[model samples]
Target: MNHTLLRLIIPGVFLTLATGCVTSTVDEMVFDEPSEGIGDATVVILGRRHASDYETEPDFIECVGKHIAARDKSIEVIGELEFLNALYPWFEPRTAPLKPSDIDKLMLQRPVAQKLTALKTEYLIWIDGSTVRNDSAGSMACGIGPGGGGCFGFGTWSNDADYEATIWDFTDRAEVGRVNTKATGQSYMPAVVIPIPIIAPVQGTACDGIGEQLLQFLSGHY
Candidate 1:
């Protein structure tokens, strides 16, 4: 990215850590610039899963996709449905998520390569991980009655999320970049007549951090 801005940011990022150990660590690595491919490049964001039943949160995917599309106006961002439809047979009746090895195999095949290239898909971004409730203190219990459900409690909990985005360059049949984001923050949820929602904003954090980093890497800024 902007080396000057990066230099300035490094100090601030480090300083923020001194105040609290619960923080986010975002690491980014870019191998080579894909300048020639950006103009007509289409990217599909996939969630890498170990189990067939597992699913990635749609909101998180949408957030990251939206940010990437906004930053790179020329790049076409494909949603999950479009991606699945385009790769129909590859996913057929039953199968587990495509591991990195599987992706490599598919990319190296002539037919697969030709199909994706025809569709103008230059990169595939695979995201893995989730946000979870780490710890909770106090209680928030609700019950339904004739008057409806109501509960009372004063409680706090921590949300910790870790996600990694791996960018595979279909043109080169190799991974060109990766971004890892770890975020942890406290959340507050209270119930008077209804529970007050306290969002940790982990997904948003990961999206913004990874999205910007991905854009910079793609544009040769990093």
Candidate 2:
């Protein structure tokens, strides 16, 4: 092929295979029902890390929080680190409540209760789960010789993200609701002279899905 034709074809191929397909679903269940209005109450998103195998990603938690705050200007979201720091040792990995019931025990302490009141923490959302590579196939080989080098072959993999957000009403000291999100997608890497990656935004899709649902749940719109 001539240089001009080759250049045009390469760009077209890249454009066609630049992105992968992603599917996402979100569900919400309310137990105690949301308050009529959020008012000045503060919402905090925290990641659960007590599990032995996997801990929720902090960035994912932050992403959900940002999504909620951006979609609803009236709702306030406190940063995970800021909330943990403000509460100090009480919120540390060893002491943080593992379940909604545990919050009852933690709140029994006068200092903890006072601090939570000071922060105006009305709702606590605990997110748990991770994105994992489910399956992978194919491979690419690359080598360099005296003349030149190039990579050849194709690769593909699938990732699944499963996350659950449990919302707790701090003021009422009860479990208010839950939001669950699942996203799955396949990624492809095709190598001609170099590897071109078409990545699926599985985790990002999950984050966005849960964030929107949480916003509606908290706002009592659902």
Candidate 3:
């Protein structure tokens, strides 16, 4: 991969899932229900994964909490790490989605056939992202093709995904408001395109470019 090109292309564009950053059009929500004022609202930033990625970044929830603080300092925000370990081991498959046991295990709210309990969590902002994939003839054929030829297919593997930063009113995990965003990334033939045949730039560039869409969403809620 061409490191220089990637560095030039990807940085400053952050639609990153780990940071709860998205680059979507802002959807404004006026606090009409009045459970708690936005200024005085206290929140716990949560980063949920497919169970695969969560294990590596245990403090990911906290990372997002920092971004929230960047957005609006008026609200009292905190990152609770005490619950991180329990949430990592269990997860529902992407096909089936997360189950009640899964949520209970993560949230530490397990009780079989339990009666409803009201939660003091006035606002639970669930920050997560969806995956987007693009595979094309150029992507594969270029990879195998001669180096210079590879650069020609640079944009072919480009695929875009929309990031979602959802606000769930903890009354029943009801989704109140959300910001949606899209991040696009592509695998390019870097060795072929690079002036010096560097590999690191190629990989970094694609990953970096993916963040822009995420940053857009974050610009709004903050």
Candidate 4:
């Protein structure tokens, strides 16, 4: 067995396992093979601003950062806090929302680009989207109209979470790829007393799916 055979066999095992977990779609928007490639560069994962509160879940952000870091040893992964610090007022979600064009302009600025260059931020991953309650059926009832009232009924609801992770190559100054993740789950609330929790697996699924695909891209595996 040669080095090439080992490389092929080992990574294939990981990829197989990764693909089995979630449904991931990768779209390569503009890919021009870089001369130096993604060798040991810094990768920043960021959550985009949204009006909805659930869009910026800390758990989801951390999940992605941790998984991406774990996937590749050579590359440096920057967490949400550090990345936000680097962007400062411009990327703040509380204020006006920013479009890709706005970011493109900022990157074109010499000072901004120089600052990011100093950080060795070769790739920028913009993560957005949320999991939300889709529909509800049945209902738990409680009423008191000047008289003692106690009501009970079983209720059920479902949640759907969809997310997208877009990759931008800072060195190339262009959008390179994107990963889309969608997951839906159901849960039931028994009576008006006991609450059953059915956690939607979207964030975990997105983290795993996006992280694996990104690892493959940066490591030149897929």
Candidate 5:
């Protein structure tokens, strides 16, 4: 990790209430996921690193990050950005713009370009470029309400989403496989008493459901 870049990022991250709240802990589902054993790999959960995005609550990036960190930093847990040394150097927080970064220019450095190093990481796991939004209002209404319904009902819901994952080997530093998986799950909340029927209940959260799908997918891959 670049100390210079991390310093700027850590403060920015701590600004958010949830920042640093994520423990480098692993989830049982992800940590126990079987790995044939990546020769030498480091994987990262990639997405919005900006603090603003994470403050919104239920960020998938945390799920992915914690999922790896909890696994004892082994082959199963990896950082995706290790692929960008010659490509997207700006991920380091330098004053560089994204113009100099080219995903295509980077190759898996693990087994091909360099030997897997323990300190730097040798595997990269990417969460992919995609977002999941809850469009199931009906579910929310039925899930919550006057004697409301199940947590997955009208106001209770778990949504399905698709994020393309590109797995790269840091040892070879070359991408090995890409998988498109749907993360799905549900979050339950109490019915907020309001002034009128026109009141909008709390926003039914469903992002974690989509995240769970990603974890499940990881379980299958190993």
Candidate 6:
């Protein structure tokens, strides 16, 4: 009700309506000559889960795939789970190829080759990394009284997302390129009488960056 309280509450209210800040960068490298077009072949995006500390989120992988497919109708994308289940033990974490060269060995198995052929899979993209909350500070307090119950205080946190996509050309049996994306953002929770959260889309930014880069890379425009 006082001028000082009004000043604090007004700023906090405005912040709640605003999204947190986010910064993202995408870098790509093409080792081999990219194909001019994909025609009817399919591209499969899979998340890497071999790390002991954290696994690449499945939703993130799906997000990138959908981004690509939505932007370019010519590109066909196969879902990560569908491709993994179709391949079975061959693409499992324990037995999956660790590098592009390793795919050569897998193709030696008749069944592996047959399945890939049946799917018309041309490009296999392996995405690895995760988004983690790095730092956080501040606090909130709440109390209930006869007058009313409310919460007050402020809090903020930072998030970083780093991911890399390794592109393998199944048709050529070689690695074509690599795309790396990094994004950082800060989220805030400002409370006056209620808590309003302003969340930063760190991982989503990373997905969009990598998806665009991959789209260009596959289209031979990168």
Best candidate, lDDT: 6
Number of clashing residue pairs, candidate 3: 22
Per-model CA lDDT versus the true structure: 0.73, 0.89, 0.41, 0.67, 0.40, 0.90
Candidate with maximal TM-score = 6
The true-versus-predicted C-alpha distance at residue 142 of model 2, in Å, is 1.7
Where does the lowest 10-residue lDDT sum fall in candidate 2?
A: 213-222
**Which of the predicted structures, 3 or 5, would earn the higher TM-score when compared with the native?**
3
- lDDT per residue for candidate 5 within 1-222, as digits (tens), equals 599999989876644422111111112223223255533434455543334432222255556556544543443543334434433543443422222133323323343223224335533445433443465454323235577444332243344344444554444435555444444444333343421122121221122433343444444333
Residues 1-222 of candidate 3 have per-residue lDDT tens digits of 698878866753432311222332333343323433554445554555555542313343454555456555555554554323323333223422132233344445353113113212455555565444457334322334554343322323444454445565544445556554445444333234432111122212222332232233233342
Candidate 4 lDDT by residue in tens digits, 93-123: 7642244445567766687767777888888
Backbone clash pairs for candidate 1 read 1-221, 1-222
User: Where does model 4 exceed 4 Å of error?
Assistant: 1-37, 50-56, 93-104, 107-111, 141-153, 191-194, 220-222
Cα lDDT of model 1 by residue, 56-113, tens digit: 5667877888888887777788986677777876743254235445666676568766
Off by over 4 Å in 6: 1-17, 33-35, 144-148, 220-222
Model 5: residue 193 alpha-carbon error in angstroms: 3.9
| Selected candidate, larger lDDT, 3 vs 6 | 6
10 residues in a row with least lDDT, candidate 1: 91-100
lDDT of 2: 0.89
Error of 2 at 92 (Å): 2.5
Query: Residue by residue across 16-91, what tens digits does model 6's lDDT show?
Result: 5678989998888988745686778899999999999999999999999999988888888999999999999899
Q: TM-scores of all models?
A: 0.74, 0.87, 0.43, 0.67, 0.39, 0.88
Arrange candidates, best lDDT first: 6, 2, 1, 4, 3, 5
| Candidate 2 backbone overlaps, count | 0
Q: Report the CA-based lDDT of candidate 1 relative to the real structure.
A: 0.73
Q: For residue 98, give model 5's deviation from the true position in Å.
A: 11
Show the lowest summed lDDT stretch of 10 residues, model 6. 213-222
* Greater-lDDT candidate between 1 and 4: 1
